[model samples]
Target: MQLGCWQDCIGAIDGTHVSAWVTGPDTATYFGRKYCHTQNIMAACDFDMCFIFISCGWEGSMHDSRIFNEILINDNVTFPHPEEGKYYLVDASYPNRVGYLALFKGNRYHQQQFRRSQQNRTAKTSRELFNKVHSSLRSVVKRTFGAWKNRWGFIRDMPRYDFANVQVLLVSASMALHNYIRRNTGNPTTVHLICDEEEAMTIVNAIPEVEHDNDDLMVGDEDPQMALMRLRIRDKLVYLRNNGMLENI
Candidate 1:
């Protein structure tokens, strides 16, 4: 659960597409990138693999960024708001705003990619080091999704529920059940055990350092202030790395 220098990070945010059945005028809307009817489920999860917030029922074809923006616009207060100087770790698909930290776009960021590249040598630049750490920490959300789908067959291959209400009900009930199990009997370690030993060790040894590669930076449409905040945070991460403090974490 240690997020290295990002101790103020509360959780991770990502979207998962769940297959669904739809008809009539809504059929096209639900047809997603997978070439099937689905629901783009936006979820936030803590380090323990427990979901903190979930927003379901968006069209499968909708972009993840769009869904997140809609959530902020429609239910800003209800959505989990990070405290001052706190943020959530999000993937490149999300905007690098004050409340959310995103990985450097066009950089090596996936766990598999990092492992492969690191096999030869460690990260060479600050951005590479940052991405290495970012990928390792953000993997919790991916594992959470895997564990969730493995446990609930209904969500894996959702039956043909003709009504949207029924589909939403099923989705909500499944998420509730997931939380209940996690809170009661779930072992956080077991969720991560699905990975092989080498990969696990890679994550453990991923102590990031700062670099100076700002080429093709993807800051998205963030306002100037938020963009600067993001840069400051990255600089802070680099500072910690160079000072040998990040390794102790």
Candidate 2:
């Protein structure tokens, strides 16, 4: 939960692809950075591995930033707007807007990259250091997706539901159940009620349906105020690291 200098961090936002079954001839619309046909699901997950917000039913080809921009601009979507000083950790693929903090640009990011960089030296530039710690804290969203897919095979492999049927709602429904399960983790009765995957799917299917739409591109322009905010955070992080005060983070 400690996000280095991002003390007001509420959670992380990212996109995940779940296998999708397409019937139309233009299946290319459903293929993105992934080779397989999938639906891009944009989610915001807190440190507890529970989804707080999500945007689903996007075609596989849509970029994460596009989805983010679409939701933010769409009047009907009603995003869970962060508080005045709070923000969410988003990867480089999304825009670093007012309430979305991202890793420093044009520097080392990702765990594996940092691991390789570490093998060569013990020292790191401020940008590299920030990216390292930023990626670490942002991993909660990925882990949340992993836990969701691990628990529900249906999410990993869809049963070829129609486009207008459960397919539109599957990702959100799964996440809704994920949050519910995470909230009641210690309750034996909840465990017993959802232990079976089929029963869990049945429960998900019973929830009221939600729908979605598509949008256009979002120009990746860094906001000046957010840029200054990141600079301030970097300065604070440097101070903490220099003083050996970042040990708790």
Q: All candidates' TM-scores?
A: 0.79, 0.81
Worst lDDT run of 10 residues, candidate 2, spans 210-219
Each candidate's clash count: 2, 0
- Candidate 1 lands at a TM-score of 0.79
Instruction: Report the C-alpha lDDT of model 2 over 1-249, residue by residue, as the tens digit.
Output: 124345577889999998888878868889878898888888898878788888887889998888998989999986898999899999999878889988787787787765564463332677777777788778878888898899888876788788657886776777898888888876232112212545444433343432212221123566665666666666656665666645522
lDDT of 1 by residue, 1-249 (tens): 224355567889999988887889888999989998898999999988889999888899999999999998885538988888888889878888878888777767776664564453455566777777777788889988898888888886888886478987788778878878988895655323434656534543464434434443454556444455455456665665666645522
How many clashes does the backbone of model 1 have? 2
For model 2, the superposed segments whose C-alpha errors exceed 4 Å read 1-4, 117-123, 187-220, 247-249
Candidate 1 off by > 4 Å: 117-121, 189-220, 223-249
Report every candidate's CA lDDT.
0.74, 0.73
Among the numbered candidates, top lDDT falls to 1
